[model samples]
Target: MPDAPAPAPVPLDRSAFAADAVTVAQALIGTTLLVDGVGGVVVETEAYDCEDPASHAFNGPTPRNAPMFGPIGHAYVYRSYGLHWCLNLVCDASQLGSAVLIRAIAPTEGIAIMRDRRGLEALRLLCAGPGRLAQALAVTGAMTGLPLDAPPFRLLPRTEAEPAIAVGPRIGLTRGVATPWRFGLAGSPFLSKPFR
Candidate 1:
C-alpha cells in the first residue's frame, strides 16, 4: 500500500489571537509556525502585557514597541541584550499592548535551512530558545508589524487534540519573576528551559 498523505495545513485565523497574551501563549503550544517555509512546532512561549512591569509596553508605546500597540495578529520583533532577535505575536484585540513571545520551537520543516542559518547540526538546539528560533527562521526586527497570517509567516493549528502543557514563571525577568506566564509543551525536550 502507498503511504498516507499528510493533512493540509490549516491557517490559524487572526481571531484566535484576539485575546490576551496569556491566553494566546498557552493556546499556541503545539501549533506549527513557519517563516518563509522554515520553522517548526511551537514548544514554549511567554506572555507579556502593558500592565506587566517586565513588559516593554508597560510604559506605553515607543518606537521599538510600536507593533505591540498596533493591531493584533501582527509580528512584534525586538532585540534582546542588543544581540539576539526575539519574536512575539501581538495580541489583545483591545489594543492594550499585549504579546506572546515565541520562546521555543521543535524544528520540523526546513531543517537544512535552519542548520545553515544557525551553523549547527543538532536538531534540539536549532530552535530551543527565542533567539535561536528567530535566527533559525530568519525572523528579525524588520519583520515587526507584518501580519502573521500572510506570506513569510504561516501558523498552522494543531491537528491533534490539545497537548499536555506545563506552566511556570517566565525566565530572565527581574520584575515579574513570579508572574507565571511561561507555558510549554509538557515533557518536550525542545523547551528553552525545563518548566519548574
Candidate 2:
C-alpha cells in the first residue's frame, strides 16, 4: 500500500506573533495563515502597532475598536469603507489596543475554493485585496471576536526566503503617513498597492 500524506501541522503558540508594528510585520513575512475552506486556506499577513498614530486603535478604546482592547490574540475584524471586511490580529496584552491589519496573502492552498469565492479568473486578483481575502477565506463578521490561538483558523511558519521588506504609509489613513509603518514583500506582486 502507498504511504499516506502527512497531516498539516498545528500552530497554536501565541508568542510567534509580536506586539509591535515592525516586529509583527517582520514575523508575518513568511508565515502561512490557514482559514476555513475545503482542505483549509493558507495566507500571509502584515501588522501595525498601537504606537502607530495611524493605527485605528491609537486614540485609545472606542466602540469600533473594543475587540482589540479585550484580548491579546483575537480577530478584530471590521467593516471598512462601508463594504470591505478588514482582518486584524489583536496584539499586546497591556496595550490592549494594538493590532496588525492583514493587508494581503499569497494563496498557497485551496486555489479553486478561493477562485470560486473571489469570482476571478486571475489568481492574483483572488486574494489581492483585504476584503476579497476575507471572502475567499470564508472570514466574515462572524470571525470577529474569535480566538486566534485555536482552531478553525491559525498561522503557520514559512521556510521560504523571508523576502526583502519595505515600509511606507498605511492605506486609507490621514495621519501617520510619514511613519512608514506598512510593511510588505519588496517587489512582490502579492503586495498591496504601495502608497508611493
Off by over 4 Å in 2: 1-12, 37-46, 194-196
Best by lDDT: 1
Question: lDDT tens string, model 1, 66-142?
Answer: 99989899999999999999999999878579999999999999999999999999999999999999999999888
Q: Model 2, poorest ten-residue lDDT window?
A: 37-46
- What does candidate 2's lDDT look like per residue over 1-196, in tens digits? 9899988866746665545546776667666777763222223345566677777777888878888777667888998878988888877765667777777787878889888877887877777668877787877877887887776677776556566677676666777766666777666676657535
Off by over 4 Å in 1: 1-7
* TM-scores for every candidate against the unseen true structure: 0.96, 0.84
Which pairs clash in model 1? none
In model 1, which range of ten residues has the least summed lDDT? 7-16
